[model samples]
Target: MTQAQTGLPDVNAVGLGAPFGWLAGGWRDFTKAVGPCLIYGALLVAASLGLTAALYHAGAIRVLFVVAAGFMLVAPILAMGLYQTGRMLERGERPRVGDILFVKSAIRQDLFILGFALFLVYSVWVEMAHLVYGLSTHKFHKTLPEFVHFMLADPEGHNMVMTGTIIGGIIAFLAFSLVVVSAPMLLNTKSNVFVATLTSLRTVATNFLPMLLWGIMIVALTVLGIVTGFVGLIVTFPVIGLASWRAYRDLVPSSEGDVAAAAG
Candidate 1:
């Protein structure tokens, strides 16, 4: 019900099945430009694997789970390129791989502010994750084997997992509400971070059921990516990113039409 004072249109209320449409549109965009999309996905996969490997090598692999969770917190920024590709495709324009890199140049300030907000949120989640683990386990885990033992054999570890999941869920939900629409909206228009964020929250509030379903789908696919040795991300990440743009397209009204309606 909240309106954008800056003349942005009201949030569109989508059906429960709308997320699937977004996915289909995203798939089309991704496949139409497979080469560039794959490159983007591969970059993400490589970074994930590289960071995981570094953690394993450093004997701090137990912290890798937290690191993985942190990825979702900053995923909006990561998907900026895909949003660009989606917008380009929508406008019947072909996007090069380099377009993804240069897209941030236009909104450097807004992106920076959004990025800092995301980072701050992620930092809080990280600290909360640590606190959850500490409160639940009451001891340190030094290795993967130790971590596994604690989770499977220790009763306290079980409590930790439960508590962490609940807290992490709240954090993820808040992060989702904050940027689910704003990220793409930022790329598509000349709006400040606050306006975009407000629009995003409005979208989530107005379409809570569908947004919740979409959130569940995102998490399911992400888990699938991680389970497949991060190989699934080669497709999952880009598709999600592209699909997100479709989501934005549906949720936010077109600027031109909305402005015309306002004037008339």
Candidate 2:
């Protein structure tokens, strides 16, 4: 059987690599990984709900803002565990569900790096949105107050929001190009963060179109999960995690271990 058929890495695998055939093997891995994902998701939901409830009982509309902020803080950390669990499963190893809580060892560093990178991207996106809004407001300075009132009352406000969202999204896409593959690569390897980040940026630049498609798919699936109130996340998270491992295995150039094993 060919290496690809056997789920082995191929030397010829390049940018955009093949769809991981191991995705067919995912059902079994899903069974093994689902428990932890569900547990984690449940904990997140409970914490979020509890916090939101507390704020609401205190008569705070700001509770929604707090919940949103908390989610932004926790999502990346939870994602690290999700991704790590998939990696363990891919290696046919058992992974503890609780390992999600601890961030020691190489995994911790990698998670921090990823979290920091994500925070950077989020900060930039937020700043860009503010900048755009500021610019628009400035340009219409004399009418700004009236315009704001009109926007608040008009159905066209939805369109305005959508346009702003699309612009923010483009900015985020540009930022992720520097870190997407690198985050997982850093998690899986002992490589330095700078190297990992650069490698990821290089991969995206070289495979821009396919990577963009992959990004869109990820965003769509994630939004679908949100629409389902996170129940869909149990499945979507693991699938994406496995897909990421496969993508990383495909795109990042092989290391010494890979070469040695290939020679052996």
Stretches of candidate 1 off by over 4 Å are 1-8, 104-107, 257-264
By TM-score, how accurate is candidate 1? 0.92
Q: Model 2 Cα displacement at 97 (Å)? A: 1.3
In Å, residue 151's CA in model 2 sits off its true spot by 8.9
Question: Which 10-residue window in model 2 sums to the lowest lDDT?
Answer: 8-17
lDDT tens readout by residue for model 1, 63-159: 7888887787888889988988887787688889998756754467888888899898988898998887867855788888889899888999888
- The whole-model C-alpha lDDT of candidate 1 against the native structure comes to 0.84
Which pairs of residues clash in candidate 1, taking residues 3 or more apart in a chain or in different chains? Answer: none
Model 2: residues >4 Å from true position, as ranges? 1-28, 47-77, 106-114, 130-156, 257-264
How many backbone collisions does model 1 have? 0
Candidate with best TM-score:
1
Q: After aligning candidate 1 to the native by TM-score, how far in Å is the CA of 148 from where it should be?
A: 2.2
